[model samples]
Target chain A: MTYCVGIRLNAGLVFLSDSRTNAGMDHISTYRKMIIYEKTDDRFMVLLSAGNLSISQSVRELLQVEKIDGHEEEGKSGEPITIWNATSMFDAARVLGATVRRVFEQDGRALKQAGIDFNASFIFGGQIKGEAMRMFLVYSAGNFIEATGETCYYQVGESKYGKPILDRVITPATPLNQAAKCALVSMDSTLKSNLSVGLPLDLLVYREGEFSSNDIVCIDDKNPYFKMIHETWGQRLHEVFQGIDDPRWDGGDSAHPMMVRSARYDTMRKITHPGERIV
Target chain B: MTYCVGIRLNAGLVFLSDSRTNAGMDHISTYRKMIIYEKTDDRFMVLLSAGNLSISQSVRELLQVEKIDGHEEEGKSGEPITIWNATSMFDAARVLGATVRRVFEQDGRALKQAGIDFNASFIFGGQIKGEAMRMFLVYSAGNFIEATGETCYYQVGESKYGKPILDRVITPATPLNQAAKCALVSMDSTLKSNLSVGLPLDLLVYREGEFSSNDIVCIDDKNPYFKMIHETWGQRLHEVFQGIDDPRWDGGDSAHPMMVRSARYDTMRKITHPGERIV
Candidate 1:
């Protein structure tokens, strides 16, 4: 299993991915799942993938040469559309979708015969020279959906354990570095709860309009910043929990009392005999 | 979809369940998913169910009168074992499992023909006289596994979003009130991230050595203590996040910096042309 998250904010974009892959409990290995595509001053893109490693690796290898016909008139010198020359992020994502479909056509039949589902998903986001930053969640079927201002992020694989933090903290106006910190915090929660997602994280911070970014790092257990985050966040969360008053069940004259019964639903039913029914 | 959690600490047991049920996005309704059984001074048990509501409701209705043959014989009248007369919690759980199997025998074929899986799970926990507290996770096939000291809790249905908090905060030594607070916090996380699990929650707390518990409450949106929890937890979490320093990208003289690159892997590969390959 893998856990990867990408955020597109007004200030920039943030990307993070864990490096563990497992076929079963005993067959665990480290596999990096992030790739960067940058043509300086032209476009910059990042792909974070999760699901079957074989399928994603195949899609990544095929993506460079994958092509969709240009919409130009016949007999004209229109180059075949590719990620490198695609004018908009939307078109680049379509190229990615086509690449995924190509791989599915190659491997989907054999995998289905083996009773394996065609499971793969990707978080693709980047900036082209003339366009604003865009993010997409591309599915195994070669279909995709873009992020909007109202929903500014996408996460794939082992997502639920780390979701509440992202739902609470991220917004369109968050700064790039701050969003990066939040992503790490979210990842910390996931790492603590789930063994399938392990360390040696890949993190990238892309500033808006830069077209290319150098803010990339690999974080293992030795990374001092992430170590501080792991320790401090857990300690501080426990402190916060301790500070809150426990529920008052005695109906005391407290600001919040838990003893009050709901008016809408009756108190829970307790059966005392063999023939008792709840209603 | 539903979310229900049951935790057994050395001090006692805690159970919490959400009350929303949905056939589809358009067909949403409220149905409570918890039931209690208590023969005061004899035994006390709580059942939390998740899956097909019809199946669970059927199992609950059938469980009261469901009987297992007793081993006693030799012309003596041995009353068929029922939950009310079961000598141990394990025997009670078997009866519950047999009830589930009976329901499946009646409806499993029709449900499978309609393309719906006969999915159901339950978290059943309590104490009967002469036995220590026991908790079992009962499945659709009438097989069950008991929770131990190492894994002192069980969750049924839509459980992942709420798991991190419980993992962080719960242990065998945790006090009853604190564990109750932890369960509520877990439920809050699930409710915030998932629309299918909603309020009017049923929460029950049972103390060790007590055959019955009156600490049952139905909590709705208007419950003041839960309202305080919802507000204070979000606010404190935000405050904790703000208190942490953002990552330093410029290699400043800070203890933690985000600019260091990985020594193990090269920077991600870039494809500049249509025929470019990663290798």
Candidate 2:
């Protein structure tokens, strides 16, 4: 299991992934899940993957050299085009989908015979020359979907544990650093709630048109920003919880009362003595 | 889909459930999932269920008169006793189990024929004298497990969306009202993160040793405590998020730094040009 997130904001894209993987409670190990593919002054792409370790590894390997027939293959000429040469982000996604299919062609049958599903999910996003930053969620079946404003981000694997904060905070207009913060906050929630995802995180922040920068870090337990986030978020959340008044059942006597007068329903039925039952 | 939670504490037990039910995203309706069976001064039990609605309803209906053999059926005098006369919580649980089995016998076959698994989960908790209070999680096959100090709560259906807060706040020593508050907060998180769960919540809080009380209410959109929670939690969380400074990449002049030299690994490999790739 893993947790990886990719956010495409107006300013740029934020990519983050945990470095832990587990076969079970006893067999846990560190594995980085973020990959960067950049052509300075040309294109910048980041891939965050989650799912079967074997399949993800294969997909990553194939993506480096795989070519989509329509977009990357030679047009009656002897030219090799790949993620390195795709003209648009959509073309890049097509190359990614082809890579996934290549992996499936190689290992999908064997995994199926062994009673395992060839499951994999990816968040691929970046910027290409002359186009706005684009992001996509690619699935195991060699299919993909682009992220739009209505759904401006994509998450994979142990996603639900970290989803609430992202839902509350992220927007297309979020600034680069703020989106990065939101991603880390989301990752912190996942690390707290799930055992399969652990620290030594991989983080990358891309500015919309920069094509590349050195904003990449591998965060372990000792990383200062992550440490601050883990400590402060929990303590502050508790403080906020405490600051909110507890429910008061005394009805009219309290300022923030728990009981409200409503006609839709009454108190739960109460039974007294052996023969009593609420119907 | 549904979300229901029940917690047993030394102070008492708290049960909260949402009423939304859905066959699919397009076919959604409201169906209450909590049932109360109490005999003041003799016994009290509450059932919070999640799973196939029809099976739960059948189990609820059958529990009224369901009985188990070879178990010490409480209160009810006879070879086979029902929930109406169960004297002990254990006996009550057996009757509940019997009720579950009855439902399984009636619908398990037909549902399985349609490829629908006979899935149902229930949290049954309450008190009967001559013994301390107890809570049990009843399963689909009529088997059950009790809640101990280490795990003093149970949740069913769309649960993960609401679990982090509960994991952070709940323990056996938590006060009854505070536990109730925690349950509501958990519910609020679920509501915000999921559309399948909605308002008009049913909440019940029972005090230990007291057979029952009227501390139950249906919370609608306009409920004051809920409104305060909805507003304060979101606002306070935002404030807390804002209080934490965004990651300082250079760490040269920051009060708390993000990047630091580490012994385990260097920075991740970055692809600087189109022809390069990390291996």
Most DockQ-accurate candidate = 1
lDDT scores in order: 0.89, 0.84
DockQ class, candidate 1: medium
Report the lDDT tens digits of candidate 1 across residue range A141-176: 999999999999999999999999999999999888
lDDT per residue for candidate 2 within B170-241, as digits (tens), equals 899988888888898888888998999987798888898887756778888988888888888888888888
Itemize residue pairs with steric clashes in candidate 1. Answer: none
TM-score of chain B, candidate 2? 0.91
Off by over 4 Å in 2: A71-81, A261-274, A277-279, B72-78, B261-279
Candidate achieving the largest TM-score: 1
Output the lDDT of residue B63, model 1: 89
lDDT of 2 by residue, A144-245 (tens): 999999899999989887888888889899888888888998888888878888888888888878998567788888887888888888888888877778
The TM-scores that each candidate's chain B achieves against the reference are 0.94, 0.91
* Cα lDDT for residue B96, candidate 1: 96
Candidate 1, B1-279: lDDT as tens digits: 999999999999999999999999999999899998878788899999999999999999888889998757797757788889998999999999999999999999999999999999999999999999999999999899998999999999999989988888899899988888888999998999999999989988899999877678889898888898899999999999999989987657887765664332354555554444432
lDDT at B124 for candidate 1? 94
Number of backbone clashes in candidate 1? 0
Worst lDDT window (10 residues) for model 2 chain B? B261-270
Chain A superposition TM-score per model: 0.95, 0.92
